[model samples]
Target: MAMRKFLINFNYLNNYKNQAVRFLTTASTLSKNSEVLNETATELVKSIVEEYENKGKMFTLPWVDQHAINSALYPFKELLNLGIQPEFLEDACLHEEKLFRSMIKNGQSIYKMLTIFVENFIMNYEDSIRMFAKWCDLLENETPQSIQSRINLFSGRGLASGIGLRRIFEKCPELLFGSEVQKMDICLEQISNFFESGDLKTIVNNTPHICLLDPTELESKYEYIYFHMGFVSEELAKSKCWMDLDLFSIIDRHSLLLKTGKYFYPDPKRPQLKKENPSPELIFDTPENKFANLVAEVEYEEWLIFRELCEQQRRLEDKQEPYEKIKPSQRKAFERRLKEKRENMEGEIE
Candidate 1:
């Protein structure tokens, strides 16, 4: 009986010893994992602080605070995971400090917003960062659903596809913000009256900034091009820089061409009489020097003098000041040169 008790006691003591060893081993593993996690987190925080110090403004607060570091950690990691460059994040922080803070505070929403641009709009990391930073204020107030709706305002109308919308945004990112949709819709509707859907799409796609103009201004520009200049919708659509030119610039250049006998208004009944003139692209797209030297074949100094005089006249007229005509001698001198040029052009034609 004594031997049996002793053996049982020995077995119990051995089992207790094994259990204690296993417990100690598990505790040690847990402690090591905790230390590793803490170290990783610390390193991440240090790296972020280093990035900010490298790229942030000299006068900005130090980024060494524990709260600030903790706040930025997850968002920075997420953004880096999304392939956004640390440089861009620094720029965003410097550009809009409070906005960046707010965005990072709700890291998930901002992440979702960027993800939408990446996956849905097919934007690469650089473009996504640009678009986000450009309109971060407006985007902060927006949800991902609202952003999708805004995108659909352009793409869903068959105006542009995903890639096309991307192009439009690349050209004029302000269109992504609020109230621009209403303006765009109104402008497109007005333009549609004059141009076919295809031509209108091409024009907007090529020069997305045109949608930023007032509706009335857009209408007046179209009327002048269509009615006064005698350009058809297809022709105007093909002129990529036509909408880019100011109305007065168009008028001044066109008037000069008419005065020089280089261009004539197209008459449907007398199409044969239309001489070869500069195309709309050549007239509007060329720089001042090229237009003067090649298109008008005038001395550069003469065009500059004429442009200055015209600007003076317009400014005086705008201010409702009394307009005095140029002195007779001055008029005669200017007209004499123009007369000689006209005669020379006629001689060449003959």
Candidate 2:
């Protein structure tokens, strides 16, 4: 048992060494435009790695599993502070431009795969906010300010700004900390509060929503939100839901949504620019996207009532046509009367 434990420890130490090397090497070439907060974080991680090496502790590769990496850097706390001004990391963090160029230049499918995953994420959350915060934490070491800024940029300015939250959660639900529902609700409440004192109309109208995640996942989540929120038909919802749930779904969905030409911002200044500091736009929507849902509910009810009526008629007739006894015109009349009766009954109590 002692020998086995030693082996595991040895492996962990090796991993940490590798991660330390990677972080330092990466930091050495970090762009001048890189966020100071993130750079500080990078420095912190490097320091921790060096300390572990000096102490003869085995370095864990990837560093996520290392207690020293987690504690010294403290993702949740440090990232939250950095978020206050995340724009500086534009050059340091891998931008979408490079992400796409890598895939296209290499003829790879990583971008597409990520999108489908993101779309299903929104649906899974039933569109809440808290879930998104947890997601951001897990996916990247972003500052809380950056997260909020991104959410505002994507969702527009309003009490119902959910695009940013949905976008992040969809892109990387695995990265977020909490269970799907818990995080989603939190995200929703926060966005709602952001718009509480302001006019939402200006935010959405001017800002418009954008998917900053890799295209595939970004598209998938966008479509999922559109479908479920009644922006698209229910038929589309089922298809999108399944498609968005696949691995690399986020990457795939993000691509597809952009392809559609339906989702776009009117502002030409920051077109396709996924920067933390955005040119502010006045395009907020009140109860954003809520109307789409109401239309969906109506469609759902119509289908449900039609199915129920068919079942009732089938049982009543024992497989024969219930109106067979009536003449064609009379049968039409009888059906119409029954439909009204059903409608009235449906309205009366339930």
Candidate 3:
């Protein structure tokens, strides 16, 4: 354990025999001269080895040989010099030299990201690598202010803080590296305009990856669901996962429900999917085989075909109308006749 502590102060691994001799001599004196010190030394030794192994297991690649170590020497030394832990280097880093080589040429971004992983979120080295590789492009453009905001954004939020950034990265890596910072600001504006101020945090808590969604597409979906369908922003915020679903799928399903007469809502009062609403899971989540019965289908494929037909009908409807505008007199007459028909049916029931 004393030897390992010496390692933090000195590069003894290259000439470990010399360091080992000194440590062993000290151990020998401690064992014979003081039994209590010897027992304390043993516990310390076990803790040192456990700490090393903890980080060593961070990444595992199939190849482990001297050659791998030889190739990784540059990065290993470079990271070590930068105060990075030795166990952070995975086997892949040793086998694949290009990662460090590229990093060496433009080490700033990589180093900055590494520090964030190590310090901010308490992420392992592998977690840093997964996120860095995906966002290296955009991260290169990130100012220090933007980087700090990014840190606070994930680490300070409620559910987002608990889940960390990995799930959002898995859901949408593009937000990290693919888009511009200005574009993200635009997206934020659209979200704020559509929903209440606090609802922004609510949406992120429900689905962090929604932050990366295209602003225009987000506006379209929000307008349809909130304005056209009469769903409020708060309801949408609770099920922000819906924003991640395919746009075409949402529209096609709505059309299918309308055709089936299972959807009934008058125009003055737009329908909403709320906590009180009784609807199938299809609207809230991507339907799987487990929910094949939601659409009265035996298989998911059949449900897909049903959506395709709805799409075809929708396209035909779009082509036929400049606007689906009806004359006021004609609309009123049709409503009156529909009311009479409903009244007659009620009379028959009576």
Best candidate, lDDT-wise?
A: 1
What alpha-carbon RMSD in Å does predicted model 3 have with respect to the real structure?
11.3
- Candidate 1 wrong stretches, greater than 4 Å: 1-46, 50-103, 124-146, 268-275, 304-350
Residue-by-residue lDDT tens digits, candidate 1, 1-350: 32233334334433444465454557665565444333433444344345556676333323568675555455655664443545455556656655465555655677677778887677775666667777777777777777776677777667787788788877877676664567777877777888888988888898877777777766667766655556778777877777777776776777677767677656445575344767777887888888888998888888888778878878877854222223435654544554567568779989
Residue 204 of model 3, lDDT score:
62
Global lDDT of each candidate = 0.65, 0.34, 0.52
Q: Give per-residue CA lDDT, model 3, range 124-188, as digits (tens).
A: 65666655655555565554456656545555544355245545545655555545556566677
Q: Considering summed lDDT, which 10 consecutive residues are worst modelled in model 3? A: 36-45
**Per-residue lDDT over 167-269 for candidate 2, one digit per residue giving the tens place of the 0 to 100 score:** 4444544323223333434443443332323432332232222111233443444343332212222222223122224322322222222333223322225
Judged by TM-score, which candidate is best?
A: 1
TM-score (all chains, Cα) for each model = 0.61, 0.20, 0.55
Better of 2 and 3 by lDDT: 3
